[model samples]
Target: MTVLLTGCSQGHSPFIPMLGAYFPYWMLCTFIGLLGAFCLRVLLIYWGIDDKLPVPLLFYFAIMLSISLTISLLYFTY
Candidate 1:
């Protein structure tokens, strides 16, 4: 993930060609990240975290981090 983000940050560089070629892979990573986070949330809820607001806050934080990371990676590659 760090490598992808670093590559994305290097705009117009030759390295970006490789990133563009693997756009689908990057997208898949994003999807997987989202899915994993969701599953974690569900597990937390199943363990009784749902009764408190902190659970939602944690979920939101995870989502926000995922989005930011994805965007940062995209920008780095492009």
Candidate 2:
């Protein structure tokens, strides 16, 4: 049996450079996700609908993951 791999390269860096320093892309994605979650939470709270969520904490977590993964995919994928 044999396995083949293709189109894999080490030419990409997962770090974003700024101010002569580098930050992980994952961290940036998480930050963006957290911000999104915070905004959504605020909107729900303002509408007095936050209490209606079945699982508020889990919902926020899901939202964070969704946002982070979407951003990562959009930014990193070719």
**In candidate 1, where is summed lDDT lowest over 10 consecutive residues?**
10-19
Per-residue CA lDDT of model 2 for 1-78, tens digit only, reads: 123333333456677776789887899899999999999999999999999999999999999999999999999665
Best by lDDT: 2
Q: Once superposed on the true structure, which residue ranges of model 2 sit more than 4 Å away at CA?
A: 1-10
Candidate 2 residue-pair clash tally: 0
TM-score to true structure, per model = 0.42, 0.81
Judging by TM-score against the true structure, name the best candidate: 2
List of clashing residue pairs for candidate 2: none
Expressed as tens digits, the lDDT of each residue in 2-72 for candidate 1 is 77766445344433234447353445556656766777678767998767755687766677568647765
Residue pairs of candidate 1 with colliding backbone atoms: 8-76, 8-77, 9-76, 9-77
